[model samples]
Target: MTAVEPRTPADPATTTELAPAAAPWWTTAVVYQVYPRSFADSDGDGIGDLGGVRAKLDHLAELGVDAIWLSPVYPSPQHDNGYDIRDYQDIDPVFGSLEEFDALLAEAHERGIKIVMDLVVNHTSDEHPWFVESRSSTDNPKRDWYWWRQPGAAGAEPNGWGSAFSGPAWTLDETTGEYYLHLFAKQQPDLNWENPEVRQAVYSMMNWWLDRGVDGFRMDVINFIAKQLDLVSGPAAASDEGSPMGAQIHDYLQEMHREVFAGRTGAHLTVGEMPGVSIDDAVLFTDAARAEVDMIFQFEHVSLDQGVHKFDPLPRNLVALKRSLARWQEGLAETGWNSLYLNNHDQPRLVSRFGNDTEFRYESATLWALVLHLHRGTPYIYQGEEIGMTNVRFEGIEDYRDIESLNHYREAVEQFDQSPASVLAGVHAMGRDNARTPMQWDASAHAGFTTGTPWIAANPNFPEINVAADRAAERSVFRFYQQLIALRHDDPVVALGDFELLEPEHEKLYAFTRTLDDRVLLVLANASDTPLTLQGEWVPDDISGAELLLGNYAGDGAAALRPWEARLYRL
Candidate 1:
């Protein structure tokens, strides 16, 4: 692909150029997540690349998103789908070259859209130069860049901690005669932030990207930056092998803020993927004093139905779901910002999991939109989510691609002696492959993701549920999201107002009000299949003659809400 040079900085004299005015860009900004591998493919290499993403920037801008978060395009060995970065400053060959990445940044900014790269600093690929050299010999200059330890008295692992994906977290290196820590996969070695030189290296790399005009970073597994120094194993939440390393993580984030990401100016945003963190702990990481991250994506709501193991699936509970969301809303309201999202590259599609996508997919999808966006946070719309995409079903274990999903299947079938059919059933219910399917651009072969075979199969229902069809329909979920985003940006109260839950006791209904000075916004969603009635003292007097701003149902004014129906009202 031809390299597109970065546009020259705006001139002060010729075009009446001036410094861009300061605005709370992130407050009302609608971010669209692009899973680059499945988004688009320009080279017909059966994989999406940076040039493909650049070509799709106009499509994203037209979709009404204010920003784009490109998932893990950094240089990697494709282990864990680019989450294990080999080089923070370079793009992977499969994705594109650095020049192509520069072109993508220039094109996105020229389109009035900011781009946030995925920052995977918690760990680096074992193939990374730093890790390769660090693991070469104990006394090497880069040896302390990653956590390493001598074997226990019996020549076993130092602790009982297990890898998040599977097996032991400590991987033995015969060459160095020691075990190195890896929270996820053996190929992804955890960085040693305790080393000041390591922290400085990371900070320097971050500033390099920021100075290149990249808007911000969507930090990958950010809270894991700091691990317990003592290396003592604690009681496990579920299994006896895996220990929860929560305390030291937050402390490291505080230091990250002091040394790297404080007081950055306009358009510089940072959202951290901090799993297993309490609401109080999340507040500390996002507090203005810490200044570590602008917002944090909490997994409480997503993990409600997840079984004792991460891949195990259980029946969904509406009541528990309400409580989880309410906790985060109230917990972060006073202290920090919440990053609201239901589906991402790591989870199943929201339509299939949360709502009855078989019958009311579009309505439920729009209803979820109304529910999540109305909350106090910057909303992130995953690719193909606007059209109510559903999860895919695989025939065999060979059909799966995600390492975590495959490991879970092996554990359930081989280790636990479960049937193969039963294991696939569980995987069908909850697997990362559900989100890794190719983006459904249109009904063409491979969902128009590529002229040739795609790296992964596109969702089978692409023809019926796709961007082209939704963009043409006025009542489509796509348009509903567009309207919701516009309303949020146009109304200041919706963006920065105080959020108050209305009728917290309602089991199947979730309602909230956002009030700032004289402006009041009421959001209601029926989270069940049965129709629900709006009642009680929480309904404000101002909305007694409220206008129906948006809804999934079509009818006269103040119409009743159907099953899984949602509405937004403003007075």
Candidate 2:
């Protein structure tokens, strides 16, 4: 647990001699996300901890990732799997102690990897000290730290806002004779950013972590930092719950940057998860002027299939997915950088959801890598994604843990009047918990996760798709990802280049090119099961002699794409 200096080439200049960059650091790096519960567990506690993550530094280093974005490992009640942070500065005992976390940072840095901790600032667990005190009394100083409202006429709820999980967003506090706001679970109370002191406190906490050798942060729901002061009902969109102050969120983000992040070391990065933001709104957050975030991870493509039902469907159209990526690429090219991602803690596995995992799992996983990494954006690789992890099938509702997933199942079965079996099927299709399962390490008992019982069961496919097995195979998805990442780092065209969509009108194929100066990188992805040949006007003139850089197809370069095959070519 001792603080070890980074073993990678250290900065030649001293801290005092280092000049701060005009913009933050994340813009220039690739961040790999690690869901701690699934990442590793050194103590055999059935849950991944800091020590376990530290033990895997070699694995990450071999993969050639630049940074590690760990999901919240802070003190929490685990009501929402550490998203409900009870304390920001302390590591959750379930994950490990503060000393262990410090060791994780030191070890990760020694492997040439930066660590970006998940910053869940929008809300805190109901058990958080601040929330407990705030809820204790109406006159408490911390009472104003949270959003609390009085009862409306006839004691009806203040508004029709629904929580993201289910039920009313407002939870009545009998002790205070008022209702407090909870956008997700009642256990999580939304913080009142309108309070200047609260903002200052948050900034102080961020600086505290940064000073402790942490490189940066992957801000969770950062756009929700700002709320509408009026607390008016939000306009109905795909969901009834509107951000109370969705319009003013950016203003608060700007303030956050100016006060907390501005003029910090260039190595300090911040990637914001802003869910309902438009391209223009996204640009505002990442624009140099804003200084709030280096890049933004929007969910336009991820939510394509999530219709009126919360978690029960597949992508509606492959064309829509391509269009969404194109739109974001074009819109953010000049304004700011995009944080490209297909899999994360809150979504299902990419191979299973977008590619065919049942038949061509390895090829599909590699194809997904080629598709996302070739885009003109910094790519984020989720844990277990390189090895093609698939969705877990729960036998019944009792097997589920995610609040959102369980709530949807109840709504579908109890409220919507659907059969329990059908509801379970829908939950299996898109439950966020699918991504939350333990990371499959090996084929041993419990996926080699822990000697004791795990917090959640590991996917049964771990034996076939595991790190050890893939590491030995030259053509494994894990190795393919390494090559893909290396290409991004070595080729300037693949990194900071211009993106031009080729044959965007193709219904079953998505192809694009990245060009910078004279160098060009061409990428093609078969978004369907059937083979399709695409001829385009923008095909590189030198492509006649182009060499295959990377691909998911099984045979030689001439082999046609199976399902969800992705290819990258250098010309």
lDDT of 1 by residue, 298-384 (tens): 888998887876666887887788778878888888788888899999989998999888788887898898888888788999988
- TM-score, prediction 2: 0.92
Tell how far residue 476 is off in model 1, in angstroms. 1.4
Residue range with the least summed lDDT across 10 consecutive positions in model 1: 11-20
Error of 2 at 145 (Å): 0.6
Clashes of each: 0, 1
Candidate 2 structure quality by residue, lDDT tens digits, 72-112: 99888888999999899898898889898888888877777
Identify the leading candidate in terms of lDDT: 1
lDDT of 1: 0.79
Listed per candidate, the RMSD to the true structure in angstroms reads 5.5, 4.8
Which pairs clash (backbone N, Cα, C closer than 3 Å) in model 1? none
